[model samples]
Target: MNRNKKNISILGSTGSVGTQTLEVARSYPEAFNVVCLGANKNTQILEDQILEFQPQAISCDYHKELSTRGEIPEKLMSLSEIATYNGVDTVVVATSGNVALIPTFEAIKKGKNIAIANKETIIMAGEQLTSLAESNSVNLMPIDSEPSAIWQCLRGENNHISKLIITASGGPFRNTPVGYLPNVTPANALQHPTWKMGPKISVDSATMMNKAFEVIEARWLFDVPWENIEVIVHPESIIHSMVEFSDGSTKAQLSYPDMMVPIKHALFFPDRAPKSNTTPFDPNKTKSLTFESLDQDKYPCFEIALKIAKRGGTWPSALSGADEA
Candidate 1:
């Protein structure tokens, strides 16, 4: 009940980003309070988080059955309920696919600050969502590393951005010949070179489709035109992203490619907390930072995705749904 602590509700408490968000909260117990949690059906991990965090309420498919066991919280809320709950201050939309879209819209409507990691939702309805957030005076903080990097770089600046340079690790098949890509296995695609992520995202990274989604996200998040946003293959992900201003000067955010850094930033915006378990980025240790132009032929999925993004409307929704399927 500390007045200084942020009351948080994580929509995907059992997923990759969700668990890391909890880790950040656990590290800074004085700064955050887990008030609510929502997950699909990962009961075992959800139960463990429930016992550890002891949130005031939770949303899960098995809530009714868990309630009968007597250890569950008194209030079992749905994802929308959790987003608009009076006791919650910020909602973390970490759930994948389109599942978190409605709940995120509800949170914005209720004027709750959102820390969203889901890309599909933004790709689908970024314009509407950003407009609603502006009208409601709510903050839609980005939890993804690229967007977070851009967000950090624009912290104290005026609206004079010239271009947004989103960085990508180029995934596991960066060096693989274009002809060999068709025969790559799922296991091969999942072996991302830099960061560990969920299976779907890993595969998306291999095809550079994740970067394409990010490009669409940046267009809406920063109000930049598609022509102004560019993606580069940075094999070493030491530099998260960069923003070039109209005055010819550029600002970039750098880290060791850790998700916790961005999550912590979103949780405690307008202020920075002390470092957690992530190692500090040392320039002396890194040999050389390299960048390459993204080859459209090598990543046809990325090109096709951007085409679909430009078309707009329900096309993005359908594309994301098809990708999920």
Candidate 2:
């Protein structure tokens, strides 16, 4: 209720990004206030968050079932309602897939700044959402590491960007032979070398499809042309991304593969905050940083995603839907 505190409503409070965002809030309690929390069906974790944060309102898909069992809170509200609530200054759209699209649109219309980690929503309706956010004077902040890194690299620059270089860890299968890729199991694909993420995203990372999605996301988030954006395999995952200016100089953002770093960056935009729970990058410990061209044959899914992105219609939405399925 402090006037100086940022009132936040996290839409996917139980997910990886959402929980990390809460960790940020916890670290800077005096700076942020949890106005609302929303999730899908993880009632147990949701209840734990509710007990800890004591938000003004909460939302979940199983609200009906909870109400029937007399376990629902009095402050229960729908995701859209939680998003546009009067007390919320920023809405963190961390839910996966298209679930956050309508709520995100509604929040933008209501003039709330959005700190979003959902790529599907952006890939599906980036044009519409960006235009709407611009008209409403709302900030559509990116919480994904790659786009957030690009954003950080462009913070103070005024020159035109020649290219935006996005880095990928190449996932667990970066060196897997093509002949043995079909034999790779789900457990093997989930073993990301640099970061710990959800199953779907980990699998996407292995297939390089996540990098492809990040490519499309960077295109919209930075308003850069498709041809101007590039991706490279950086197995070290130290440099999140880079931006090259028309003058031929490039700036890069480096960190030790942490999702919380980007989440904190997006939440505290236009200002830098002290590090919380994130490790400082140590250059001496890094042996070598290498880059390579992405092989289209090794990741046909990545190639197909780029094709769908270039099509630039409802095809991105279809791609997202198909991926979700």
Candidate 3:
């Protein structure tokens, strides 16, 4: 390990966001040193990541045999253990759903910087978590593409924002008649047009639950009210998100719909390194960029999530848990 490299522990080292984060780490090896890795059940790739990164700690479901030949801790560490481990500079909380909440708060309480991708954590306890992070003086960087876009747009504005406009890809069934939604199979729903993601999030995108969660996340991350956050369906996905200033000025962040862009942004915040995984978005190829309001009837989850965001209790957690089950 280089003496000057920032040490980071990845909490969901096998998920979509986790793998993309590794790609960012791989591209900028001189800037980051991955010291710990955690996954749920994908031990095969977890072992591969352990070998490649040679992390001091590793973890997976309950317990499992690992095939790595390095000096990893004899006992597998839990996500929280890796999160709050001493000398860890940053904890990348990419674990899906509410699983990330406890470990994320642990890292925050321990004063470790957080780069988070899990929207469920915010939905479940955005108020509490943001307050905890602020009180600890820890940086709670957002890794979700939409929130990251808003973060970039809000830069230098210093709380001068009036509204947040979150963009949605509208999923595979955007054009499908509302009457046919009940018969859509899981396989059909998983086919996201612009982004490749896990099944749960993909399904959430289809139902607009993912956007709903993003609205909640944006509210917490930017300290905006739920009433000020709006969702629009941008089929092209070229524009990730936008922010409107109090004076009617609007700024937006645009990039190719690649998760690596946001992941890398979080990893080297306050600084930017050369990116290998994301290419500049081409407006010529984009042809027609369009936006439309979300059809409430088509995605009832959106309104429900907004209500849960305002309610701010265990309701959001319950909604996510029920979706998982």
Predicted structure with the largest lDDT when compared to the true one: 1
TM-score of each: 0.97, 0.96, 0.95
Query: Which is superior by TM-score, 1 or 3?
Result: 1
User: What digit string (tens of lDDT, one per residue) describes model 1 on residues 72-112?
Assistant: 88888889999898867899999998999999999999989
Q: Candidate 3 lDDT, tens digit per residue, 1-325?
A: 4659889999998888899888888888889999889998887788788778888877677445655454456657788999997889889998886787899999999999999998878878888999999999998899988999998897777577788999998999999999998999999989999998888888889889889888888888888877898899999898999998888899999998888888888899888765464688887777788998899999998898677657657777787787777
Where in model 3 is the C-alpha error above 4 Å?
A: 1-3, 68-72, 275-277
For lDDT, candidate 1 versus 2, the one ahead is 1
When sorted by TM-score, best at the front, the candidate numbers are 1, 2, 3
Pairs that clash in candidate 3? none
Best by TM-score: 1
Residue-wise C-alpha lDDT for candidate 2, range 231-289, written one tens digit per residue:
99998999999999998899999999888888888888767676576788998998889
Candidate 2: regions farther than 4 A off: 64-72
Weakest 10 consecutive residues of candidate 1 by summed lDDT: 62-71
